[model samples]
Target: MHSYFGFLCLVSYFLKSLPQVLCQRTHANVLTNETDAFINRVLADWNSPGGIAVAVVRKDDQGAWNVETKGYGAATANGDKVTENTLFGIGSNSKLFTILATGLLINNATLSPRLEWTSKMASILPTWGLWDTTAAKEATIIDVMSHRTGLPGHDFSYKWSDDVPRLIEKMKYQRPSAEFRDVFQYSNNMYSVLSYLPTVLLPSKIPFTRYVKQTIFDRLNMTSTTYSFSVARSTGLLADGMARQGINFSDNPFGGIPRALPFWATAGNEDGNLVSGGAGIISNAVDLAIWLQTLLSNGLRPGTNESVIPAEVTEKVSAGVSVQAGAAQFPELSPLVYGGGAQRGTYRGHEILERGGSIPGFNTQVARLPFDNLGVAVLTNDNDYGSFIIQVIKGRLLDEALGLDKIDWHSRFKALALTTPPRATPRPTNASLPWTDFITLTGTYDNPGYGKFELCLIAPKHPGASRSCAALASNAPTILPGAVEADIPTFLAEWDNPGFSHIRLTHFNGNVFNLSTLSSFPANDSSKPYWTHGGDSSFSSGAYAEAAAEGRHVGIGFTGIWGAGAGVPGPIGSTVRERAEVWFHKIPYDMDFHLE
Candidate 1:
């Protein structure tokens, strides 16, 4: 009787301990189906076009690694499904690779001591002329990487141009947004310039793309990744790009009746021939997992004795150099700091390193919790919902890894999206101002940072369209699809060189004017510019011109959002509330003036 009783007690004890042991193992190696379901549910709920792919890698209790991959929706509207190998633009995530490549060159002792991060740009690229020599000379490589150069994002400078060298040459004209090392302004142009450094310095004369591939991608066996869109397409791995048909929520299929957008319309459109250090890499979830694993493993290849990136270099590159304000929408993640190419922050008591990238039709996010030995990479093709979807997935994954109760990220994000205010309607135009009101506005405007532009009054084609001195003009013929028609009263705003030249403007109110292209304005708002075409297109709410310097000058502010498509929210300050403005001084058409 005693022996039987002891056996029963032992069984009870073992039964109680079994769950604890299993739970520990599960925390390390196991990913619950509920987590997968949640990811799928979020993507489905968003009705993400071209689908989404996610890769997760975590370490088991015994130090062994496990990888989980999930793909939801189709890669194309024709029903081709997303897979682990489907290629998607990684966007600015490419910046991290560029920074890593720089670190590698430094590690290899390829750069001279004088060319270190603290070295002046003028010293490094001496022949590269700069308008503000003093400020340019004071700017350092570290300043560029950490975005403390006081140079605002002159994103429009290269938004549609493939000529990187010309872009670099134009940098001389751009003014700093703030004092040296005083503020953080993300600048893709800086990174694009930085990408050329390795080619200039390397004895072998290899391009930046080749250098990255050899040192990083090749070493890590990330074969599916490349900086070239053509290369990705050649491999038949690139996913089709997609966009929403109309801006209104009523146009959303999931919201009410299913309204199909012109999916796959932009499937094979080429972004450009040039490589961008800031936002050009194309990759897949499978390869990105390897990337995260290598990073988390302290620059060593997983399950191998080979060292890829030096641990010291990784630490140096990721060390916080500049502080960033916490995201208001994501209050849980606070104290964000910008490092070399990554962001360091704390989420729910766990330290994390994260980076996000967005291009025309793709959005990507890679996040790591080093202490937990967990990492996640998400790639999606839908620009509108991509950012929100990625965040929800990351949050859910973190909850699972940390054994915390799951948060309803999907519902919260959905609510936020639905609650976003609709675009404002333009007020009715009942009054027309006399041509004398804008008499002083037509002149050559020069900003040392942005160069020269001219605003000219166009002669009216129709008798009723204008008076003798009226500044009325007509829109240009359709250069892009869905552009404004030529009959609208317009003003020709031309840039000195190519790119963003030939903007047609129509008067809206007192000093405000609307931009029009070749096509008729949508019935919703003819006063606002809409970018229906894929890729980088400029849009504006309106341009407001005000007299300054007691009529000596006119300050024109181009207020609107700029990005890939119409009706999509871009980076903060991209809306009409903030604008990129330039001042025009009345000068002789034939007279030449040097910008101070």
Candidate 2:
């Protein structure tokens, strides 16, 4: 069976490699009865509590296409459903524009990929140092585009204020999280560098926003897009702008009202400015379609005197960046790539140009099926479950645009359900006990990045091991799937065992001091004072019980620290690029647990 599957895959790849003839003939429509069923099923699985908005676009002929927009609740409740041209905040999908800006500069002979934009490289912005000295100095314009700056994913300590000088000053004291050319970390700060590139090249200094508007937006005629939140506010889009903030919630099949927070208006910078390489743009679907058309035409504008990106530069940008294989591992985040901030390779046998964005309120997706000259751009005011919708919708439409194997999206959803582990209730307090000594097991503990924890460790089976489990300090209930008991000392050490699916703890030494030491396996509902203090108190008691009772999903609540976004780490601010430092919270001292 493996050999047969491998042979089939090879055949698919060979067919995929062929130009238009075979590729066009084999296009499969994903909008069939089966496809519709699949779409509905996946949406239901991922939809959760909040509403969803979806849009689909496909190329029917060389110059022909159609667009369909659908909304599940928010729009329907207000008697206003989204249309083909409904504006969306395309979050970090705006980074591609930063790359495009670079391409434009190169085309105009104002920038060179080979030139090192460092102090020793004869560039003007020598003070704007690359994160690494040796290898960073050697990096060119292309490396920055690939997100290889040695900085950490974000700087949690810096403020996301609208002041550029403060950001630049703060960055001066910053350091690199990783060694240069060592690992691919998706550093939005690199764009902070790119955002300032125009200033370095210009005889007259220009803010990042002006550079984008004049060069990229003006040339492409993306009239609707702008980098300034003030402009968005003036245009009567404050509500929409606020809605685009990327607030996150539990991963339950029934998602709840997200922790909506007000976002400060920020000027677009090159890194995360109102116009930098990361997110910070708002535009409608129509203008973006033009942008897509330009990309599909390989840099050529639809009807114009210029190409949006030079062919060589476009290839340079598209060529895969060096990165570690397998998905990025961030707490609570589904695995995704850590290179260049987007998945750039082929998906489902098509050479796909893809990008997605997640901000406080906005979630967006843009993809181009180059072979079929098909492109799609989806933007939504709410991001709660937008990414899933984009993937499902795109998978369906691409099947139609290019003849490929019809995927049963519903079956995939079914497969998702089967794969999710079953939740178990904790063992009853009265079930069994070897020795119950709970006095000397509470105190404060600390780890650098994860922060401090207050623990009340208990020897549930006391007189068995040590009288006091030094390392296992928390007295908090230790909840696990199903129900099992072992020595507290041994369990605390191996709580993070490979076999365990879910385990939380209260560390007296500061890291997770109040998570899972009080309860035992799958307690559906308990009224113990589990958490007293420390960390961002984000989860509600009802929220946890509600999620666990559902069994389909389990929400392991982590305190809110800097860099809280899933996949995206640290805080985003208008600062120079710096080292990637993982942040941790401090634990309180009242709890009675001791360090080993």
Candidate 3:
């Protein structure tokens, strides 16, 4: 769902007008009650049904950290107030912890054979192999962590039955959008795979969750940051999540009316969460301030000689290994570059490093001005387009602190959001056949790496558009993807998977289908907390959400393959063959591999 092509187009019109407002700037100020008021205003202006907890921390003249943590708006729908300790899921900001843990392992004196950024994945991870065999052999820890692995996030491919091991074994099946090391392509699967390294390397061989809790969390005194929400909720401080329906870009500052989005069940006393290294974390502003303070203090606990992480660890994590996006229209922000887990570049000509994450309902922004010893953590329980609200708050504060010209973030965001729709994608050369031709196509489809899924037809709202695979058998269909279909569906293919809900597929032509679900499925129930896409524990969705929502572009596609070269992403330089999107193959009613 993440490709920012649409976002680029939305903001294109505003480029010519940037000079008009270049002179305007926000008055720099200390963190005070007035700053709290402005935050509440932004949340209300954005129509957020939930609140945010923000922590701004910086080192002072005495070289000790100064922290200001405050809460704004209602923590829950009924008006529970947010405070410094209100727990919220920090989403992919958890990735930074994973990266830091890797750094600690590298710095460990007792680890045999020693690991470094250049330590080859093939040597450490026996199961590590991609379509590009040579790339797999040569790819290092940095390549995978920095997202230079050439693979896009085929997020729905892995099932959690085997957790990280199954996720690792499935890598050869994922297709790459760019050549190896050629571009920045984000994939959570890689980070999850990194979780296995400690298991293989450590003498004690602890899992990632245990290692992180011991190595970093305990050292920093971040007592409340944990994977177990059961513990968090018991304190009655964990914030409930809320979200808007679809991406309805509008001139109205209000977004799609928000509904409650429930907290994840797996986060509470569950034995396994497959993507823990990638996204599993929940913390609040006050605790995260300690994290930021440690980062700003160069991996040491502020006001102490002790180190939570080695000083060189911060340097290693900050070195940019991949250029993420250069689409900046203004001079204030430079093209983004990513290293380890966070993104690093210049903001207002000063070096800045930041990253953001979101699942279904919550959004997180963790940023720092390393050179200036300043950091900010904003945990929000609402999701708007781009989680732009978090940025609006962060941008405003940073502009004031850095003494840069203040650009009207909200107006530009609103205007670009409400832009007239772009032209529809040109239809493919192949014409779509009648609805009758598509129903039997329903059944199990498989790739060795992605696992098997049964594609059954779900009933459509419009009787005229409905086709039934249920008639093929008396077996009742499982629960629908969402509450029910609203519009008449036509020749739709439906299936349930780990990552997406409220989704159906339209046959583009033949066996080719676009990824219709995670991109733009409408919100089913806005009155209560619910979300349609990026089902429970979907991490790092913010990277390509805007472009995918506006353009309805599907980087995730399914095309049936036949004949010899089926379901295989062949070797790197192999003849540049014109293979169909052969990621998934049609199988029989039973679990047989051969077609009927």
* Candidate number achieving the greatest lDDT relative to the actual structure: 3
What are the runs in model 2 whose C-alpha is more than 4 Å off? 1-79, 110-124, 162-175, 233-252, 255-275, 324-342, 410-596
Candidate 3 residue 539 Cα shift, in angstroms, is: 24
Off by over 4 Å in 3: 1-29, 245-257, 265-272, 327-329, 420-436, 459-498, 507-514, 518-582, 589-596
Candidate 1 regions exceeding 4 Å error are: 1-32, 127-134, 159-162, 250-275, 326-328, 422-425, 434-504, 515-580, 583-596
lDDT of 3 by residue, 487-568 (tens): 3222233343334442345333433333344422333445522345432111111111100001211112243211111122
User: How big is the positional error of residue 270 in model 3, measured in Å on the Cα after superposition?
Assistant: 7.2
Which is better, 1 or 2, measured by TM-score? 1
- Give the total clashing residue pairs for model 3: 2
- Report clash pairs, candidate 3: 2-544, 260-529
When summed lDDT is taken over every stretch of 10 residues in candidate 2, the lowest stretch is 542-551
Between candidates 1 and 3, the TM-score winner: 3
Each candidate's TM vs. the true structure? Answer: 0.77, 0.60, 0.79
Report how far residue 444 has shifted in candidate 3, in Å: 1.0
Write model 2 residue lDDT over 1-596, tens digit each, in one string. 33664566567677765344322222234345664565455545654323334444455543544544444433221334444444456777878887767665666654444333222321435554543566445666656666555555443323343333444434434445456655566655566566666676766677767887887688888776777666654654333312211223334433443322233335442323522446667666667777777777677766673876777666656666655334522222233333343555565655666787776456678877777667766555544455555555666666655555656544453344444343333334343321212333333333332223333234344333333444342343332221223432222322221112223342222112223311122212365312211111233221110001012211112322222223433333332111113322223323333222
